[model samples]
Target chain A: MFRIIKKSLKIGVVTGQYQKGEPAAVPVVPEVKKKAGLFKRSFAIREVDTGSCNACEMEMNALMNPVYDAEQFGIHIAASPRHADALIVTGPVTVNMERALKDAHKQTPDPKLVIALGDCAIHCGMFKGCYAVTGPVERHIPVDVRIPGCPPRPADILEALSELRNGRP
Target chain B: MPEARLCDDVLKVAFPAIRQNAPVCAKSSHFVVPKDLLPAITHYLHTQPNFRGRLTLLWACDHRPVRDTYGLYYLFTLEGSHHWVMLSTELIGNDRLFPSITPHIHAAHWYEREIRDMFGLIPQGHPDLRRLVRHEHWPKGMHPLRKDFPWDRVLGRQQGEHHFRHIEGEGVFIVPVGPIHAGIIESGHFRFSVAGEPIMQLELRHFWKHRGVEKLFEQQTLIDALPLAERVSGDTTVGHGLAYCQAVETLLHLEVPRRATYLRTLFLELERLSNHLGDIGAMCNDTAYALAHAHCGRMKERIMQLNDRLTGSRFLRGAIRVGGVTRDIDNGRLTEIVEELNRIQLDFSEVGAIIFANASLTDRLETTGILHERTAWDHAVMGVVGRASGMDCDLRRDRPFAAYDALPVNVALYRYGDVRARLRVRGDEIHESIRLIRELRGKIPDGPIANEPSRSPDPGDWTLSAVEGWRGEILYMVMAGEGGRIHRCKVRDPSFVNWPAIQWAVLGNIIPDFPLINKSFNLSYAGNDL
Candidate 1:
């Protein structure tokens, strides 16, 4: 027990301070509104991987790590879609996952925002016209925000979330 | 090109009649055998005392307009001799049927099913001919890998449900798990049969996330397919990319410079390091040891950041190209890597010691999920799972590709075949990976990084490349078509073999230990589903 405490102390402020100061790596997210005042409270998000290579998932998971900690901003990865205020969908929607993606979106309460979180999610990226890929995430359900990259970095993800917290763009 | 001695011996033993007719080694090592002789040759080679060649790959290509029949290739790696023998046969006419090797080689079950689903080839005696990749909703008589099929065409889903095999008994109740999970993981379904606490049977339904990767590869040019290969499995970008490049290099006969080979080795080890740390942490997390998980997560993130510093992408995508790696690391960057690694090793070992000292954590991992040696061999498991089970095979040591031939790798092996053993293997491998990186630091050769191919590869040429990825052996067989196009590319992830064995691994363990056992193997759904 003493060792655990000692170890924690040595690690020393592992969590990030994204809210207090400018983040080190700020990816350019276009179309950020200055003052919409939509998101003033903490948000709970449920991540849905339609059919990713898992690169996006890794980056999203990294956001919860000590350096890029999203939890410090009161953003949490909810266990269930029912508990979430927004749905963050990744990858191009495969045929088998289309129904499930819609189901998760339906399960989340009304007024819940849907953020499509990769190039694949935005426009089916490289997987466009794949036989198994039905369409992009928006084609199946409505999307409020789209973050594009093969996989957006952890900072880019936080920036997008912070943008959403400030206003719906 | 000199013929390997084992290849000559295999020919002499399997086809004695062919020697009297004509010399089989005329068309290089790859021999085109008569369709009827395939089963006999396979059976003889498999049963022969001198030549116990393991069936490595079985795939089919649609040869329309040029030929009426679909051409099938079976590659076997003869053990102890490092000899690869390629045998091709054509399944003539519309009734494309080939004798199944599953009756003798049990591991051929999935490959045959894949061939059936992708190329519309019928395996005559396959026990389970149900859809492997394509689901029940897919239209009948539509094989997507054929050249005639368009890459973008999507037939609307037909009305049907995949009939999962169920256990019916008085007390055996079904516990169906996700196509979607409570966690932020990819989609895969697992049906468990439990009497009360103990699991009676496990039925799996993956391929939910199959985004027509193979078909997409067929659409890309030889060099353009590197990005697609990198995304084959996100965590294994380096492994898959290197394997694809190796095949392309071999096909075009382009030699990668010494400096590039060392750099490739560095990235591969880095990938292995990050993944192993993440998996070890995940395994602990499953047992509710959140502290160890957090520490490990921190370590993993550090490695990923290091990857980003070296290469542009965190996963090391776009770092590797068709001929060699795109990025080059000099001495100054190498010093930074060594210093960071030293710090990480100290931090990681301390965390590992803490986790080990905890009795509850160690007890939970000790004997929870045991996969016996006999069962592992029966399934022909690869990578860490196989090593944990005492199936002593590491492709780096056995096949020795890339700069691996220059240096010896001390493969971490254990006989326990339990969750603890798997964890131990990963821990040991982490240390070994760090050691490997340090050894590669000062010894890197000064030369050109890449060698551009002098000429485009001839049509109808093909080659196979295998890399011992962090998970296991990742194999890519690239076949060229007319006008420098890829005819067919078959990707066989280690998960393709390991996923089936999970059903057996969960036979006696309770439902609670499933996640722990699953994490120990840590099989990639994307790799298998693709």
Candidate 2:
């Protein structure tokens, strides 16, 4: 648990990206002490594969393993919406899978963060503005973080979620 | 004397329905056969000794001249020969009816429904033409491939397919799985009619998220269209790009320099390798065979790292341009790429030997999802999947394209027609791909990475192009009107044809083995859904 948090927080500190949306300009919000992010690292994540080829799924599976060590950080990905605090949605959401994806997002609790994992999720990366997909993640729900890799490496996804916990700069 | 001669005579006997002498100027040997004689033509073609007339491909493209009109294309191939035949028909009137060849080519089942859903064409005698790759509530008559179907319709799509046609008996119960499924997959409804756990009937519903790729092609410029093609199926990104780019090149008659061909060849192989890696792992994962899957995942990761080294993108998008590829490898990168691929292939050999040696994996796979040799011929499925089912066909070897023409593709053959066969064939092909990639690494020609700077194509010209995609032969037919604004574009993925065989394969097997059977083929749901 300490490992994932530290790694994720370190990525945040390094990249200096604290939130999902890439902000061009902002009023200096005070560096509020995030007690919410500090301890008890149990994250309820909801995964929505937006018409992915399923490589993202395999990468997600890696995070569940010992090497990527996501479980150690209390970043628990739940199957149910009621329990989810973070929604992990992959991109290029096909025309066919769009609705259920939206419903799942709406079902998640408030103060929830959306992690747009994989290049397809970030800007519809490879699929890039295709017909079936009219979304990067923002088109459908409030995407709080963008983990960009063709499939973001497991480390990247873990890092994005951790940074979201601390809030964006 | 033989069935080949007899089939030729039958082709003559059938007369106009099977056009024996159409204008061959289209660079295709086969005729535009009618849907009615598909069975007889294919049946006779298969029976001839050494005839090797394999069913090349069965696909649908909404070759629309107007907003609501569309046409279907079914392409055929000779078993070992390079020649091919095509059958086409316009989907007319409100009903949009066409004779289903499922009875003849069993492989036509899923494809027919896909045509039904995507183009709103009805296949007569289709037995069960409920939405194969569409959600029920996708709004009837709004086929995604049709020209007029709006793109914005995907946002608020509903579960319109819940009330499917079913058989209600004293104890028959209908269990409808989600447009939203349990795990990480796109939305599709699978309604199973069962007395107990034994499924009597199964219907796979999809199209909850239909973005109308074919229809929308009319609206984009060629450069923009390449990205849309790449998104056809994430697993087959490079393949789709290759197909589309190849078509554009053909239209422009621009020769891709040797280096570009070599680079494109390398990326194509890499794309195949990565997807195969993911497929094998996912198949095993689905079948409760995690040990082998994990190792494959590791091997896949190595392949991805190689992709990152060669091109900046893991998926290798933007790696391909209209005439040639955008990315080029330096000699050092080439050496490293070959060395890394060789190492990965070696590790894969260890993994392959282990998986093949394991009796449990084979037991579950062999004869588990049997798509009989006869049925394989009937549907004219393409790529590794068809070849495994006793169909000796590969576009690379039979109809040479890219740097593949230089490389003698060792087309892997498997007659088992089951999940194990598909797995075994993929394993064999991976080795072949590795060998090809290594040999072509240093031989790349010296030239510009890409050329012909971008330009628009002329209107009123229609071109038909197909490439040996990773999954199989992908057919793309493009027609543009009003000075290349785009009249219609029809794209076909092999998964559209292969999915129905799953229903047949799962029938006799106990319900528990459905996952293994389904995973063996591992046809892309989204690829077909589009």
Candidate 3:
């Protein structure tokens, strides 16, 4: 709707529901490289909201928007925990949400990567050190990365997912 | 504060409109009126008050047969600063059919609907008392809030696509939008009956996202209640948390230090400023006003930056406490806030000028969602939504608490009761908020931020606290337990009453504008879902 940018002969741009795009970043697989094993291109992500303000939900949805199109990065939010190679958890794991969080963490396939999205999940941020809350996600499930924001923008969420998918620091 | 004097010449002159109870001016936290007369009390409130007697607040209720007595708890904030009263009436849980005040107060119609869904208490005389915040698949006998209702009852009930019925008529088509859609706000369905571009009627079916927040809050201790409050609606985090903390504080009769109070007010306004900017942008975006909406988005991000600077978090998280606020302000921070508020006001003025002055924007918004002035008063609407439509109620100006008493609260009013007026009021409020922030900084007392009150709230003490937040008045009713845990906790977000009004407001508007109209009110899904 915004016509701010000058028109261009657009390349093959993707549009539609639940379609996967080319992977933006592929894993290095350093150890596999030493053994001469090829790195996998596809990534499976599991999304869980331990407890959130739902703003994180906003950014999560944003990732799938026409602009960012998280699927364009070959990262998909998987339904079953068993299929996920990485966990994208939001909110400050509250006492009530701990069991489910740990359960999901356990269910994820081995060689799992954890990305704690938003400040609430990383440091418990504003909700830190509360009686009802059990964590900043690290207290229950080990986190590979912490994306800070009351909620990070969609780009930030995508960045976290892509980083974890590639097994990057 | 006297029963005899409460009925002076002015009270006597306005007395007749309906049933009258000499308000038991009880020295308790918050205010109340008896429950049996809930219908009559709201009706009487409509007629008697001298000031804007339109707005009313309905909190949570305890609808259980305890010793053969069921109590319905609520708080009232009369339009204009006339009265703030709390009411509780005992009823037999099944005899819970209290007469609906909706027929009298248009707003009570929806509030009654929600209470029925959650508590299984019918609102007698309610025209359409169907569920407002629950799924259609939700069980008939399962009242989620009832202490006895187990958590499993809502598990499978939460999943599945909702069923919506269409009306068979010539040129009439039903557009069922959501239960689960693309965007990530929270799930709810809006079924619109449209003839061409114009909407014939709209029925909102929600509760897909109801996570049993209220049930969890009841089990939570006062210290542990913050997480639930934070998740009610992410956008208005600080605003609602402060309201909850104030309620618990009042129940214990604790005094928040002035410094703590000022900081709470500061954070509240900052949250308000950011939300309004974002909302104004979204409203423009809804109407295809891309330039104006994007400009506002830029301003909003700046406000978020200001939030990150002043408090370590952008959404102003965990800034409130029961006795006082959590964070402290430093000298350099005070200087930064003054500059940030000034810069925000400057950018805000430009967006306000462009939107209010533009013809295209007004053509889309003005009179599109016309919530009648009388209808607004009948619902006892609060905050900017009520104020814009001439339903004069703002808790800070009327019912003073925190730093609102020390500074000025310049309420913006518009008579048009249209989307444009709502837009105008929001811009005016931003200016006023900027002024309020300036004033608070100037007069802020330099001292230790908090004092831990000596006493905790006693068991069986039924106290309610209500504050005017960005959307409207948020009321919290607390019934303390033996230890630190809460026996019953009710958080009444204004959207519980206002969302249904949208059903009426959207009756005649075109289908395209419903989202825009709803955005102006901007009621929280999670707030009501709780």
lDDT of each: 0.83, 0.67, 0.67
Best candidate, DockQ-wise?
1
For every model shown, what is its TM-score relative to the native structure? 0.93, 0.81, 0.77
Fnat for each model = 0.68, 0.31, 0.13
Ordering by DockQ: 1, 2, 3
Alpha carbon lDDT of residue B198, candidate 1? 95
lDDT of 1 by residue, B22-51 (tens): 222222256677777777887776667666
Segments of candidate 3 deviating more than 4 angstroms: A1-52, A57-158, A164-169, B1-4, B7-41, B48-55, B59-68, B92-96, B150-168, B182-184
DockQ of each: 0.63, 0.24, 0.12
Model 2, residue B140: C-alpha shift (Å): 5.0
Chain A of candidate 1 compared with the true chain A, TM-score: 0.83
Which residue runs does candidate 1 get wrong by more than 4 Å?
A17-40, A167-169, B1-11, B14-31, B37-44, B47-50
Predicted candidate 3 versus true structure: per-residue lDDT over A1-169, tens digit per residue: 2222211112123233222322323342444333211215556667776666677875574465444556655666676678777777887765445556787788887777777777778787645544345567898887766677667755555554544444321
Q: Is 2 or 3 the stronger prediction by DockQ?
A: 2
Model 1 lDDT vs. the true structure? 0.83
Write the residue-wise lDDT of candidate 3 on B1-530 in tens digits. 45323533343354333233444323322323345556765566567644334435554456343355556654455433355544455565357677677776675666667778777788788877556555454445666666667543423333335455567788998887744332334445689988888788788875544556667676677767875686677887887788778777766778788899899899888888887877788788889887666567656666765676666566787778778877799767877888877977876675576567777777898788988887676666667787788866677876677899898698899977888888888888888888998888888998778777677767766565667788878877677776766767777788777877787788778877877898898887667665
Ignoring the other chain, what TM-score does chain B have in each prediction?
0.94, 0.84, 0.89
Better of 1 and 2 by TM-score: 1
What TM-score number comes out for model 2? Answer: 0.81
